[model samples]
Target: MSEQEFTKSLTYAPGLPKDATFYSGHKKRVTSHAVSEAAENALKERGVAVEDIAEIVFDLQTPFMAGLTMEACVENVRGALAKRELQHAILVGIELDKLAEKKMLSEPLQSLVDQDEGLFGVDETIALGAVSSFGSIAATTFGYLDKVKPKIIGRLDQEKHGKVNTFLDDIVCSIAADASSRLAHRVRDQEERRLPKKR
Candidate 1:
């Protein structure tokens, strides 16, 4: 058979194409409200107030992205939380930090977490995984937030706070970083859409 005839003889399966859905339906299956509530409860248990976290999120987002409102930042964070992967990361990172704070880990590991060792990079690594969801802007934003340690992040890092927030700080930073990236992408898309197209 000729190449054209051979190709025509092949039958395609009839079903939904794999690429039909850009995003997994899981994002819709999980509610952002539920995710936000769980995150708030977790933070509260660790002595960080939801309001304080919101403030920090606002601080991280506004400086880089122009005209990004506080409400938008809050919504972005809620949206990020809605991702099941991020939700799992946040819970696991927080719980691991709590365990370290309570001295629940064995010898060397406990010492690393309790002392906040410079070499102990697991916490930041875990948080980094979540940041990647939003692309390169998220990474750069996370670096800035990590360096500045603005607002609640700084408070959480201090020894006087009496709470070991090793992972919590980084996780929150990732959330804020993701939100900032989201805003940047949205604004850029809007601008692109406004531009005239060539014939």
Candidate 2:
């Protein structure tokens, strides 16, 4: 197949008309390249490296997904980052975190976000929306990451990071969770394809 045909095949989903125009302009801007660039820039601005984020994702996913390579895990993270909804979530979450860091919000809300108040969980809730796209496994993985705060995630949450990462941390966790779920699905598909056909 031609490259254009391959690209079209990948993007076409059942029940969604290929010619349907939805957010034509915005969707054009939401390409995989754009999403990856946005994710990288957001991480860099927060004093976190993409490598560190990828490493955390690798560590979080490899244990559950046997035979999954670090490279594959990293690629899955990139794929997760490519989703337009996920890109939007990352941008919104980081903007909220920065606003909270600067105390730009008003009244009790400002105080709640700045202090990382336990009861104030709107940040996580926003991040959770991104996790739902990949199904229940993504949600469970996110819950695990939230509770464990492993590796780079723990560091990002520290006061020494010089910023409130209340939203960013959850956003990262959701990314990793989504990536893990994606990898699991891909692996299962491969395995099923390899099974012997019924006579």
Instruction: Highest TM-score: give the candidate number.
Output: 2
lDDT score of residue 177 within candidate 2: 86
C-alpha RMSD for every candidate: 9.4, 7.2
Clash count (model 1, backbone only) = 0
Reference-based TM-score, model 2: 0.79
Span of ten consecutive residues with least summed lDDT in model 1: 3-12
C-alpha lDDT values of all predictions: 0.74, 0.79
- RMSD in Å for model 2: 7.2
Model 1, position 42, has a per-residue lDDT of 85
Task: Estimate, for each residue in 1-199, the C-alpha lDDT of model 1 and write its tens digit.
Answer: 3333322221234464644423332234456678767876786787765456557667765666667677776677666666666677788888878898677989988888877788888878988899888999989888888888888778777745445778888887887787777777887898999999989
TM-scores of the candidates are 0.74, 0.79
Clashing pairs in 1: none
Per candidate, the number of residue pairs that clash is 0, 0
Query: Whole-model lDDT for model 2 versus the true structure?
Result: 0.79
What is residue 27's positional error in candidate 1, in angstroms?
22
